[model samples]
Each structure stands twice: as structure tokens, then as C-alpha cells.
Target: MNDDMTHEPSDTTGPRRLTRTRDGRMITGVCSGAAAYFNVDPTLVRIGAAVVTILTSGAGILLYAAAVLLIPEEGKDVSIAQELINKQTSRN
Candidate 1:
């Protein structure tokens, strides 16, 4: 058996991380980050979010807020909600 044939190829792009983008952001960048992850236009995501929010009687707003707290900003490791939970637990 050849040594070269036993090794698997490595990915150059590395794993895809879902992080909020600093560029082209309207607010918290949740839609932009999701758009980047899905490889779609940010505008489309924003429009869809708006429509969902309207149709769902503003439930989408809560979902968007949750995403903002759960999704880490670009260049950061932990998310806002995670940090807050950690702080609260540490204080006890």
C-alpha cells in the first residue's frame, strides 16, 4: 500500500462559520449573516424576514432578536446570550 493513497485531502476554505457580518448590515446583521451562510442576497433575506414578521403578527421580531443574541459577531468566539448566561451563572 502506498503512503500517499492513505491520506485524505484537506479543505482549503475550512469549516463554514455562521457569524454576523460588519459590512452591509442594516441592524444586528442576523439577516446578513444568514444570507452569507446560505449564499443568497442579503436583500432577499431582509425582505423574507419582513414578510414573515408581518404574516406571523410580529413573531419574527422575537426570532430576529433571539438570533442577534445567539449569533456571535464576526471575529468573536462566544455569542452575546452565551456571555450573559455565563456572567449570571458566575455571579451565583
Candidate 2:
């Protein structure tokens, strides 16, 4: 008697999400991004960001949300910022 088994390779894909980080100062994607990048809890980064924002009287809240709308979701294969654009460009 003989037995054989085959398995397909697993796919490698990074999670894509809007970051609230200082990259653009729009929101608090920094923490989320960091968590994904370094495998850390995003809450820690958020707390750190909050502590820093204390000096500014919670100005970071507005900035964090703004970042959510600004930053683009990460791509599956390639990890890079797609960027947010307002006006559509004319195709040449």
C-alpha cells in the first residue's frame, strides 16, 4: 500500500488599512500602521500618540480622523501608499 499527499503554498499578504500617523498628520494611522509593520498592539501606539497630543489639547483627534480619509488602504501584494487625489487626471 502507498499514500501520497499534496498541499498548496500559503499566500503572503499584508493587511491594508488607513494609517493615523505623522506621515501626513491627518489622523492616528501611525499606531495602526506600526502595529501591522512591527507586529505590535495598535492601542499602545494610540496611547503614545495621545500622550504626545496632550500638549496640544487633544489636537491629535482631529488629525487622526483626517488621516483616515487621507491615507489609502495598503495593497495586498505590494505594501505602499497609493495616495489620495481630489481631481481626476485627463488620460493622455
Candidate 3:
């Protein structure tokens, strides 16, 4: 005899960053951030970044690093003020 299991899956979803790899907030270490976000090997991003740096003469690298530092962490746990801002953004 076997017992039947009849349980509905609970919803465990919420807004996540556009890039699970957190592309937006990654510092110039875009490769690293991309790797983390997309759950891909960082080596791929590293190789890509290296190629871009060589082709673009470090401009890409510089920009990537700048972005990492400037970008906010994804899934930033909402604070009271941030929630208010979100509400305002939604209204208009």
C-alpha cells in the first residue's frame, strides 16, 4: 500500500534583480558580477572582459569597475524609506 501526497507548492517568489547575476550593481568586475548573477563560471566573464579590455584599450574595464562600486546591491532588503519611494514610483 502507498499513501498519496496531495500538497500544493507554496509561493516562494519575490521581485529579483533583472539579472540574477546582479549585472547592474557589479563593479567593473563585470565578469565576476555577471558570473555570480547568472550562475555561470566567472572564467567566462573574465575572458570576455579581458577581450573587451584589450579591444577597447581598458575603457571597458574602467567602466565596469566604476559600475560595480556605484551600483547598489540587488534585492536590497526594503527599508521603510525605500518602501515609501517604491510606493511613490508606483503611483505615477
Each model's TM-score? 0.82, 0.43, 0.46
lDDT score at residue 78, model 3, on the 0-100 scale: 49
lDDT of each: 0.81, 0.48, 0.52
Q: Summarize candidate 1's per-residue lDDT along 1-92 as a digit string, tens digits.
A: 65432322122266877888876689988888888777677888999999999999999999999999999997788999999999999999
Residue 8 of model 3: what lDDT? 17
Q: Give the best candidate by TM-score.
A: 1
Q: Please report, as a residue range, the 10-residue window in candidate 1 with the lowest summed lDDT.
A: 3-12
lDDT of 3 at 41: 62
Summed backbone clashes in each candidate are: 0, 13, 6
Residue-level lDDT of model 2, residues 3-85, one tens digit each, is: 22211112236443433333323343555665545545556666877886897798877766555555544433222333222
Rank the candidate models, highest TM-score first: 1, 3, 2
Highest lDDT against the true fold, candidate: 1
- Could you report the Cα RMSD, in angstroms, for every candidate shown? 9.6, 11.4, 11.0
Q: What is candidate 1's local distance difference test score?
A: 0.81
Where is model 2 more than 4 Å wrong at Cα? 1-30, 75-92
The candidate, 1 or 3, that scores higher on TM-score is 1
What is candidate 3's lDDT per residue for 14-92, written digit by digit as tens? 4333222343234334454456555556677677877888999889768665555444444445434456778999999
